[model samples]
Target chain A: MESILRTENLCKYFGGLKAVQDVSINVSKGIIQGIIGPNGAGKTTLFNVLTGTYNSTKGKVYFKDRNITNFKPEKVTKLGISRTFQNIKLFKNMSVLDNVKIGFHTQTKTKMLDAIFHTKTYKNDDRICEERGQELIERVGLSDLKEEFASNLAYGNQRKLEIARALAVNPDILLVDEPTAGMNHIETRNVVELLEKLNSEGLTVIIIEHDMSVIMNLCHSILVLNHGQKISEGSPEQVRRDENVIEAYLGREE
Target chain B: MMDQVFSLIQKLRAKSVYFLVLIGIFVLIFPQLTDNQYILHISIRILIYMLLASSLNMIVGYTGQYNIGQAGFYAIGAYTAAIIATRAGYSFLLILPLCGIMAASMSAFLGFPTLRLRGIFFAFTTLGFSEVVRLTILNWRTLTRGTFGIPGIPLPEIVNFQISTNNHFYYLGLFLLVVMLFISHRLINSRIGRAWVAIREDENAAKAMGVETFKYKMINLMYGTFWAGIAGGFFAYFAGYISADSFILDESFAILAMVLVGGKGTLVGPIVGAIILTILPELVREIARYRLVIFGIAILVMVHYRPQGIAGAKAEGRRIDVEKEYEAGISENAVETTAPGN
Candidate 1:
């Protein structure tokens, strides 16, 4: 598969501590890749750096063969990269419909007067956004909750809503952080299935997961990290049998 | 039967076309409804406050920034107009936009450093800034006439026709109201408006979405303040006098209350709130001292019982299904978690 994202020698520092050190990874187009490690192993920090949540202290990131190191988060999003927060960050007070509507905001070109006057172009665009939002809500299986306040939704549904919101941005690359962080085994399996389905549709997915079962089942390949460094990277079976990987997971309480 | 009614409801709920027509008809026929000078005077004041509240909504509601310095910009507009009309003898038509520009410039200056502050701190800083501007007006006796205030401000004139009557002033204010309302509508629908909403909802997420939060916020502040300035200019000429007292913290709170009581971030809510609040005092002139208490009680009840005001449609009796809302939910119960071979 052709590579869509490449990171070289990426590092992040919190004061004097090196949170993510000398990390390099490549994500190919149209694949479900997984990153798994124990707590404080820099899984999230690496996600942050790649998506421009935190500027890398050193090194470069390239997407579609263009350097995007130290770019703003929104700029990264505009460059076809989108992400979900590990802890869901949704517009809680807004309706679920409005939440998704915000995702299309970056792509919308209708003028303010158009919205106010309900001009033909504005009306058409507004209809399109609402219809598209409704379609996405249905795609995520939340069509029944279209007009409900986002904060009022059940926890599991909120996670699904986040994905729908991200999809509204029309992203080519989706970085979902902890899709099943608080889910039961069944939910985790369901999430893994969904990620697989998305990958089959020709979208690149880079998932950060803690569940070993999920990582092992969903990922075509897995990259293991320990102490901000890569300990192993291969097909799940190959990494599972690696001595370093076994020692890394067994030696640490995490 | 339900389908026809639903279609009608949907048409009304759509929020754009018909609402414009309704407001347009109301504005045009407003003169025929009442010829009372007191009513005219209050109508003009309502228009001014509506502009203030609408712009304030952009910041406090849309951008999620707490700002109490609207009066500072209001004063800036008043002072700018007072200076020009008195010293330069400029016409009201010409002075209107100039005052707006001056207020916008001053707002940008105030908003630049303070945009970093959030919540109550931001609110307090703006309050402090307003007091400082008030003090400056009080001390700068040479230009402002200090505490005594500037008097004999000229009314807006067309050719040799000065708008001397309250009816004429009402028309002028209505004209300004329409213009400012148009601008507000335009600004809110633009990319700048979306950025403001994103910032209002989640600043970090908005930044992640590639919106320049600070810049949009500054624009929000400037636009709101600029309109406030124009309103102040109108007040200066309409009242035929002005002083530091006219642009006090009470004035700030009153306009803020108007927006909040009406529903912040909504276009017509502020206008409705401003009109009701402005006209209430006059209606209760018999026991003038009790008017504020009555207004306070009404606001309190409105806030507690109907927090969304007229503009907040969802706050009413509608129940929206949470399941079909956003596709953000999943069930952990259905997936069977099995080990590698189980």
Candidate 2:
């Protein structure tokens, strides 16, 4: 499979702390790749570096063979890589539809003059945002609550809205950090099914999840992280059987 | 009863255009009905403040940037108009946009280094910037004429029609306000507005959604300060004098109070705020000495009760009420069906 995203020995350090040290990851096109790790194992740090939220101390990130190292988050997003937060970051005061409409920021080009004059570009872009925003909301099954403020949504629904907002970016790769965090069993299953459906539709997904069941059931391949270093990388069966992965999860026998 | 009230609100919202037209007509003919120069003068002040507050709203309310130094931009506009009109002898038409552009450039200069600062740090920088502008105006005697102020500013003329009367200034102020409102309304309803609100809500999320947060913030600051400059230029011509004292830190706080008391995010909120805050003091002349104290109380009450302001978009509360009503309806149906079986 063709690799869509490749990182070369990416290192991100915070002074004395080596949060992510010389970690390399390769994500193939059109497959669900999972990164699983214990708390404070720098899974989020890796995602932050990938999405340009943090500058890697050393190493390069290549998106489709293009170097995107230390690019601003907006620039990274415009290059068709969108992400969600581990802690959901929906525009709480905005309506659900408006929240999703904002996701199309890069795709729209209505400047001050165009907006003030109500030019053809403004009308066209506004219509596109409204129509496509509605479609994305419907896809996330939040059609009934489109007009509702995002803050008013249930936890699971908020997560869905975040995914819907991320999807509005029309990204080639979607980096979802802890999509199923704090979800009930049913909600977790729903998210798993949603990811599966999206993967089948040809989106390259890189998910950071803690639930072993979700990783085992959904990911085509899993990368295990312990102490900011890759402990195992393979199919779920192979990772589950790996000695390092076993010791990392269930500690070594006394 | 609740349903009736909701329907009534919906009907009012649907007919809001007609109501706006009626208000517009009233405003258009207000000077004709009133020969009172005091009322006209006060009305012009209200209009100018409306412009200032609304512009500041774009920064504080929409983009979620706290800019307490709006008076700095206003002073820049006024001084730009005062200096250029007196020395260079430029037309009001030319001077107006120059004033806006000058202030916008200053805001861009200030915003470049400080837009990265979050919360109170950014706010303090703006406060400091406003003071810096005022002090420069005061201390730069060579250019600004020190505490003596630039006086005898010629009345603005449009094709030989002199804007000397209070009524004339009121109309000019009204025209400027209308233009600002029209442009603001258009911008707010479009993609630019959505990006601003997104940044205000969550800067990181806005970035993740591909909004260049810094660029947008700078744009927002410039657009807002641009109007402050215009208002200041208008003030220079209307007041027929320019002084450092006019654009004090207190003036900045007053404009901020108007936005907060009236409502920040909504366009109409600042207008309402400007009207009440400007007119209320004149109406209560006996308590005019305690104006600041009263403003403090009003802001306190507003913050305690309605932090979103009077005309704020109450999406969260309104939606929750609707959901409650829907759940109640379902429970009612359940009770009705069980009663028939019993």
TM-scores for the candidates: 0.81, 0.92
Question: In candidate 2, which residue pairs get closer than 3 Å at backbone N, Cα or C atoms, i.e. clash?
Answer: none
* Candidate 2 structure quality by residue, lDDT tens digits, A91-191: 98889999999999999999999999999999999899999999988887899999998888998999999999999999999999889988899888888
Which residue runs of candidate 1 sit more than 4 Å off their true CA positions? A16-18, A110-135, A182-194, A247-254, B1-36, B159-161, B186-191, B276-311, B314-342
DockQ of every predicted complex = 0.25, 0.34
Q: iRMS for all predictions? A: 8.0, 14.3
Candidate 1 per-residue C-alpha lDDT over A103-222 given as tens digits, one digit per residue, 9 for 90 to 100: 776677665556567678776767767899898898778899988977788887888888888888888888898888887776666667777887899889988888888888888878
lDDT of 2 at A25: 85
The most accurate candidate by lDDT is 2
Candidate 1 lDDT over B117-198, as tens digits, reads 8889999989998899999999999999898999888777878898998778778888888887786777666545666777
